[model samples]
Target: MTAEEETRTAAPAERLWDLAGRWHGVAVAAGILVLTRVVQILLLVGLDRAIPDPAGLRSNLLIWDGGWFQRVAAGYPQGYTYAQNGALEGNELAFFPLYPMLIRALSAIGFDPGSAALAVSWLASLGAAVALHLLGTSLFKSRRAGWALVGICCGAPMSVVLSMAYSESLFLALVAGMLVAAHRRVWWAAGLLGLGCALTRPTGAAAAVALAVAALVAIREHRDEKKWPPLVAAAVALAGVPAYLGWVGWRVGEVDAWFKIQTAGWGTSFDFGDSTIGFLSDTLTLADGWVPMSVALILLVALAAAGVALAGRPWLPLAVYGIVAMILVYGQAGYYHSKPRLLLPVLLTLLPAAAAAARARPRVAILAISAWAAFGLWYGAYLVAVWPYTI
Candidate 1:
């Protein structure tokens, strides 16, 4: 082949590459989100049909913790809730304020609490998709990777929470947006987004620390530049989680009130993975329910995935955020079934798969992700529709 022949052959490929470069990544992320949601909803509807006494798909979306969030949207209690036996019980205080606050604001415009909550969650989920795309593109310098990240995250096992009346969507949007801003050295936006994240969920603390790490990295790399902004951004982000925790303590007139409420209400406390290990051991060895065993396997796979992501040497702040988030999820003693949902927003465990998919041929990657979504969407739908316990 001569040079002219090679140039002619390469021109079309070059044009295609240029077209892809001009395509809007956010739109791709949105498309992936829509596709995943459609698949998940279809799965939910099919599963709900097979189950006895189906409450319909909408009701299933609002079941379990949806009531708690709705009550919170109505109003928080003045103090802790207690049983007739005088034992403290879990109450609205255990939940963070940011998510319900948005719900309340939307409800004030005439929408019911449930609709408002769902609206906030769905809108936040869109923001999360866009932000996650930005984060992936920024980290890997590949739009394909960004789209892959969005697709994988939306289709992750138990990711149906992203569509439900839950704070996970809001928290994910804020955290990913913060990371994107930090990576771009937009300290103010990063700081504000980080603060939002910290207020949205307990794992926001991990995000806050991650933002601080980003700031520190920036400061170190540009020693002579204006340092105050990054310093201030780190300080603001670092303060957010503690500030909310302090407010909760003051509201309840006990420094440990939030921790107490969490433990009393949901048996949620940091036991350094003891409970998780025990559950995994029992479920795997004792041959418990399929759901329990599946959850155990998911946990193990997530841990392994995280290790693989770390071995790839991700951006330092992201690595820190992922590590801390995993620690919080695994170290806590809560509903074993809920671990997968909690792991959804961690983002770290999904990175390796996303990157691999991004590197594969387009057809191969699509086929692989479709196979994954088939199982993940069905798994999530089954938990909500067929399983008797909370996700």
Candidate 2:
């Protein structure tokens, strides 16, 4: 091949790896995590001071899923039982074991469960940011674009969840890693990551779908002549579903503990048009002060949908993931509060926009991303300050 052709062929891979290996990426990711955690701590402290009653504050600010996680972390699993409303008639099997399991393990290592959970989440958030950077660079073939993508994630509204004791960060990291492996045609790695993601969150099924579709496309384009590892990888990724269900059944005496728990505890049954209409109605009426929040949410949702629609064929895997995730989110009943959290993965939609902008006006893309990051920082700080009351 000619030198120019060779350079062009190798440039994307080289740029991707170089960006992945850089100290700048590491520093930026670390900075985001640190800032987020600091905000969390400040929020906690502020809540404590404002409430005066520590118990009441804890019950309010850090209650719900956070409280349950703390209990699991404290090595008190024997009394563990799911409750619909503080009553122990429900099955604890409904809750996935991954995050709580990690919290328990970390507690065994001498760290408090709360601290351990937060620490793990913080690290996972950083990893997700890095994975996002690499994914963007690979898809866009520009290190600068990758950096901008990472920067945007650092500031994304979802940073609030990343800083908390939630499983979103870890789930995002696993999903991103799986995507990276799929892109490289590393089937086994993709499958393993997908399984891990499944264990982390139920919505992780989206990763398996994305990978499976990608593999199918690869197989068809090659007329089954090429050895496509993605087929096997996709299978491996889906294996987590049965494995997790079996474990939950054995422990909770029900095969659908996870589903039941989500349904009963969170009222998350599927309801497509109703949920969407509810959100839209609320947005229009400005009900529950939904104006600003709705605007932001709509912008994100629209961008994600547009990106998938515009990609035509090259972005099939991402499109599949995005579409499935949106369906899952919007299909749920009583989705007003949780919809934003569920749409966290949709942030990947920004990747195509970042790519298009980088190819056209790289500098403008960088500036825009930087502005988003700044907003993220400010929003995170505000959340920390008012988390006890509003979060």
Candidate 3:
């Protein structure tokens, strides 16, 4: 009945209420994600109906990367090898295991691998939207801003990749989860998520670096740092790299299995200088002829600029992740066409802007996001159904 006791008791209840309030944005994001997935499914179904056998259409509908992932999921890895012209080649080592792993697990329970892959990816995409909402809410200190950020990400052109059997949705979910855990200073969770991210895609390295840097900064700031959570996070995040590398090394008797496979098999070499210049030149030169290429290039520049602008803010984690992501994508010697999808995670930069936008004009933010989502839906449908033929 004392005032201090009442205040203490009330504080916890207030915090719970605040947390509940923030999740409204997550619900809204879920709605948007579901709607987008539904649209994609409808388009796919329509396409399937139009083309009974759909064999020839498959080549156009499911081009390069998607076919590789499907083949891997279908248990045809034996036909694949690490080297391109080294005789053994299919898809075994070329693609990472996480996505296929999910497909396999789902298939074990009687689901078709391809359908399972798509289903798992769809769910992961929803999880990613939720994670983005949470991340934005945490960074901007507003639920509205969080919702706006989720809308932007879900509506972005890259959102179409989520429907595919690709690792983007899975990776995005892991990365976003890692970011949220890091923002809360929950080192163990963040580290675990970081490890999961590494397992998902190459960008996992960027997530690991961002988490490690954040942890180091937290340690340096705390004079009596007895807990050492950040260090724990960094260690956990890094554990996956060595474990993965060691496995690959043991399997192939090479410490550089990953690098070699990446280079030789996928034509992904790390030529920092030429890679950066080529990306810029190609982007500028091809900007007029190709719409996707142009949008990707502009988005890359926008993300880089956003990172720089937000670097001084309290949310240094976002800037760190964005900068590292941009650097990684720009450093790639091949897959230049994928620069847009590669920069998907960097869209986290939009969180800060979303927060500011929410404070100034929440309606404007929502409207813009809606427009983008509409475009993404239309573009994704077109790509799956029509654009593949044109290409």
The C-alpha TM-scores of every prediction are 0.93, 0.79, 0.83
Residue 323's lDDT within candidate 1 is 98
Model 2: ten consecutive residues of lowest lDDT:
55-64
User: Which model scores highest in TM-score?
Assistant: 1
Put down candidate 1 lDDT per residue, 152-232, tens digits, no spaces: 889888889987888999999999889888877778888999889888899989998998898889889978557887878
Candidate 1 C-alpha error for residue 118, in Å: 0.6
Can you list the residue pairs that collide in candidate 3?
80-89, 80-90
State the C-alpha lDDT per candidate. Answer: 0.87, 0.65, 0.69
- Sort order, TM-score high to low: 1, 3, 2
lDDT by residue for model 3 (1-391), tens: 6798567535633543375264565578798788777776566566655654653433433455666666667663322263445553333565666777887888889986667777788789988988877777676667776677777776666566777767889999999889887776667788889999877777777788889888877767765544576888877876765676566666766776667667765567777748667656776776745665655565566666576556646466666787778777777776554666676677555655575557767677767767767776666655556444321
- In terms of TM-score, how similar is model 3 to the real structure? 0.83
Q: Which lDDT value does model 3 have at 196?
A: 90
Model 3 lDDT on a 0 to 1 scale: 0.69
How far in Å is the alpha carbon of 178 misplaced in model 1? 0.8
Q: How many steric overlaps does candidate 2 have?
A: 2
